[model samples]
Target: MYALLQSTAVAPNSLTVIDFLADFVKFWQIIVFVFGAYQFWANRRERLAADKVREAQELLDSNYQAWLVVNSAQGKGGSGGRIDALTNLARNAQSLAGVNVDGAWLVGVDLRGADLAHASFKDANLQGALLSGANLKHANLEGANLSAAQLEGTMLQGARVSGARFSAASLLRADLADLVGWREIAAVNYARLQEIQRAPHGFREWAVEQGAEGNAVSEDMSAENFSTQFRAV
Candidate 1:
């Protein structure tokens, strides 16, 4: 009888040990689950942030390419004249502000009403390009080929036109106020005379005395009518 009572006491102690082990295992499982959930949430947040950065980079690249296409379309003869590319750029001209297309070929491209402020087109081929109403304020066109390019109502305030060719380019009603390096422009007689009427005060008469014909400005011409004639068609 005494041995049987001792065996019963040992069985209770073993049961207590088993219950303790079970509690410990449950605690460990809860800790692991919390840690795993935290890691998953952190990884998701990182992925979202990376996606946003990539999207921004893609948008910037697209804008840069648009500017390049328009610049390349401004080529002379066989070098340029991609009408489809020019059409695409014209449709998205608002994104072209401050684009850098330096030394590009842009002959005969239609760039009407483009926002080209602070853009770099230095030494670019803009021969016969349609640039009516373009915002060329503070733009760099130094040594660029602008022969026969349209410039009606274009803003040339603070623009650098040094060594730029304007052989037969039309400047009718174009704003040339405060143009940088205006005296150094390589312009023919017709090009020089076309913008003389818009020159500041005595500058017009001075140009006329310098052999620039002053009869190009019609007395019956009005600013509204002049702008209408040069509107992009």
Candidate 2:
């Protein structure tokens, strides 16, 4: 062995042989280290991700049970205590509509249906939450982070949604009547006229001037152009 090592060390091509073996050993070690590191990181990431999912699911189950209690009370007479309990559960449910749960940590809660009208949820953390069919009418959701939340069929009428991030959120068939731009409001007015024209309720020349609820007023046609071509129909 000594003779062989000495021959390899002193040989004319000895440098090349030493270099090749060194490189081969380094390459094999690097491959093993890289795989071990990768496996460790992957397992750690998966464990953390699974923990978050489990926590979210547990919150959903708790909220659903609270919903059942509130739902049962609908057929019976109740007082402020029931309202308080429902409010507490609503705060936990991922479907919190208009409740005053501002700045609460509510990640991944399920709040699909519950009256949250005029509730305040400003700056709440609601990522990955399910809020479908919830009534958020006139609710204060300013600056709330709702990224990855499911909001399908939710009523967002008159809600204060300034700076509220809904990126990648689901909003299929959601009621955006209050959030309509001027152009959409105009379209609604035009459709309303068409409905009035096709009414079988003897509504000849019915007009809906914007006013406080239910009170109707007539516009002065004489002050404006009376010709059919110039009519404001």
Candidate 3:
């Protein structure tokens, strides 16, 4: 009779131990689930915070410079967090035209298809920048370093290119339809271009005179400041 009583006591202890183990596992699972939810919510909030429209609206109610607003909560930062801010500014469709962005350090910036019409990029470091299909009409690009920049299909109609470097830059089919004087100063070394015959009148003859291999080439790194930016594209 005593042994049966001991056996019953041991059975209850075993059940209690099992219950404790189950509770411990449940507690840890709850912690893990809470942590995961927190992470997801944090990431979602970050993306929402980078919205250009929201920032624009906020600007109306706050005191901030348009340039300072370019920095996106800054994870995808460029040289000195300028990339994030510049990108946001470029994407925002609010009267960017005629804004003076002269001498901006925008190296390797991906501004494809942004409406940069009439914006002054004079003397800017645009090396290896992706500006394809972007509107640069009537913009001032004087003395800009566009080496290896992808300007394919960019609208450069009436834009100024005085002393601009196009070394190894891709200007294939760029809308230089109204640009003047590029043939005199544009450095087209290894640059991609339309067939000389298909190019705007006089571009092909100019390419052959410059001794390019089926393309226009110029060895003039005018002012020796133009450096090659080994672009992958």
**Full-model lDDT for every candidate:** 0.68, 0.55, 0.68
Clashes of 1: 4
Give per-residue lDDT, candidate 3, residue 202: 72
| Worst 10 contiguous positions by lDDT, candidate 3 | 221-230
**Residue 160's C-alpha lDDT in candidate 1?**
89
Runs in model 2 lying further than 4 Å from the true structure: 1-98, 180-233
lDDT of 3 by residue, 118-207 (tens): 877777778888888888888889877787787878888888888787766767677776675677655656566653212457765565
Look at candidate 3 and give me any clashing residue pairs.
Answer: 70-85, 71-85
Estimate the Cα RMSD of every predicted model relative to the unseen true structure.
10.1, 16.1, 10.1
Best by lDDT: 1
TM-score of 2: 0.39
Candidate 2 per-residue lDDT over residues 1-233, each given as its tens digit = 99998887788687779999999999999999999999999999999999999998987777777656555544343231344455557566445443465665455566678777887767766655667788878787776666556566777776766656554344544665554222212111111121111122322122133210112222421212212212222
Off by over 4 Å in 1: 1-87, 192-213, 217-233
Error of 3 at 131 (Å): 0.2
- Supply the global lDDT for candidate 3: 0.68
| Candidate 1's TM-score | 0.55
Model 1, 74-111: lDDT tens per residue? 43333343434544566565545676656676677787
